[model samples]
Target: MPTQLLSAEQSTALGTKPHYAILDGLRGVAALMVVVFHLCETHATSHLDQVINHGYLAVDFFFLLSGFVIGYAYDDRWNGMTLKEFFRIRLIRLQPLVVLGMLIGAALFYFQASPAFPAIGQVPVWKLLLVLAIGCTLLPVPLSMDIRGWHEMHPLDGPGWSLFYEYIANLLYALGVRKFSKTALAALVVLAGAALIHFAVTSKGGDVVGGWSLEPTQLRVGFSRMMYPFFAGLLLSRVATLSRVKNAFLWCSLLLVLVLAFPRVGGAEHLWLNGLYDSLSIVVLFPLVVWLGASGHIARPGTARLCKFFGDISYPIYITHYPLIYTYTAWVSATRPTWQQALPVALLTFVTAVALAYACLKLYDEPVRKWLRRKLPVMQ
Candidate 1:
């Protein structure tokens, strides 16, 4: 799979780069599934019963995918770049949405007054602001100051925790991991993958779904989840042999949806079996999905356009949509609405999230990054 070339006008309009377009489409596909998963969570009494049972694995997919992209994009360019410059580019690309997510979460905090969070109504404005301030820095809030009753690092924006780990990944790449020899990186990935497997199998819930808290066990889950896939992705980029695959995007996407949308592999009686499923999917299945996506070229005009649309919206939709999920979660928690009763409202939440993400991408994220690129001039 040779790099796709763009004409001058197309390059100008879409920005310059040789991207794995199918990979972009896959990412967008995963992001959309995440929203559906969160919506289904509203109806679930617990993780065991949740629909879209394995959607949390999308974050691991994202981590692996991120590492691969970063390696492919940046690994050879460090000679011409500084650590400060690298951090600046990542921040410009990612931080605007972080700020927007926190703000949206804060705005909707009170409106989400429901029985699940009985103390929600009594939470102080200043405390909310304090949490917002911390969240803006992408730092975890302590249990003492838990504002949303979920004890999430970012109570206002639950998904901010992933971004926090993402930042850590970037920092490691910039400071140290990028310097490792392939053999060293492989060792790291192997160790991390083992730890991830152990954590998944032994986890109380028998899944690696615990990345939002600041507590010790959850912190282990977060880092365990983060390490293997991110580094494996990096390794994949270094070693990938890009062979042409027919209808690769369609096939890869179907696999992704099936994995994420599949029912829990094992019920409560055999939790460890499900853990094995989760670990294997992250360590094995996800990399295959990414490889298939990367090895193909988009041949059809319609498919190319579709991948472009999804690729563009993927990050914006991901970072911005969780705040809306918070509101939906509140609603469902309060009303205990059946799927039939909640169908219309759930559909509305999905549309609103997609619409909001698109609007923010166009009006806020893109414009901000453009300006940052102009002013900073070192975004690579």
Candidate 2:
């Protein structure tokens, strides 16, 4: 996460630039929470009752963080970099793991057969290959080709849809949004926030969870979910001032965990409450979290090392963990295991997810990126 951008300061004066180290660790925290949320999701009877109630909001938090990071990292440097160069750098950093995630998903696809995915074994290898082909390009497979009953754009790896939108955000920034005046960017944020609020208040479940599909409604949800926070983060990076804060990493981590782990408010009778909560958390709290993280430092060596380790593996764990989740989900769906019966499998799933992520990061992601950087010396 090294950058060649302005160090945020109230003075608007030049000084030593710093990376948002704690924010990286906070991202790892959210990724871990997502893993826990999905694992718990397998046991829940419905979305309304799922444990780790606010895990979905982590996606929104991610969008906000991404916008801020993009602005912080690349805004001023665009003077020396072409969009082509920028895209190449992003691809080198991000695409290898995307390919790895799809491969893992494809390899595990058949093994995931269970009552919920009874067709997994029967699905043709060609179809699976077709999915891999499309997934590698980050395009959603058509509904006609959907192997799983769920209409996920990337059925093999459910998390890929978020990456799809991530690319959209990147492209939008490169093409137009980056040039927007702060006033224009703020207006976009306001409009996006409204879209998000409308979707949340109207949703029967009062959540922002349906962004995986490619249909009109789902795409609307996806963009609505994406728009405000991404732009707001960009805006925050451009305008907000960072200040020294005590114990920021700890405080921001707790704040993130508290918001994400809090139970769903306003179940059926008052849906707006949950929607408002989601809105406020993203629009208000996430920027504060980022600011706080930016303001803090890791002074203790051991904690610094731990944060670095988790931060290093964060993206790998997130992008790869969901495939194992598919298998675990299928098993739970078929077996309907009580928590007592399910505990061991759950534990295994959690351990395996971490191990697989770490392995993919070290054995695949790093090697591929290193090769790309060597090959594309210009981007270096």
Clashing pairs in 2: none
Per-candidate TM equals 0.96, 0.94
**Looking at candidate 2, what is the lDDT of residue 288?**
93
Cα-based lDDT at residue 164, candidate 1:
94
**Residue 191, candidate 2: C-alpha displacement in angstroms:** 1.1
Question: Best TM-score goes to which candidate?
Answer: 1
- Best model per lDDT: 1
Cα lDDT tens digits for candidate 1, 1-380: 44342211123323456767788888889999999999998889888899999999999999999998888878887888788878887887789889998999999999988887777899999999999998888988999989778879998888899999999998988899999999999999999999999988888897989889999988888899899999999999998888889899899999999999989878988889899999889999999999988888888888887887787888889988988888888888888888999999999999999999999988988888788778877733
Worst 10 residues of 2 by lDDT: 3-12
Task: Give the per-residue lDDT digits (tens) of candidate 2, residues 97-140.
Answer: 88889999999998889987877878899989999999988888
lDDT of 2: 0.83
Stretch of 10 with least lDDT, candidate 1: 5-14
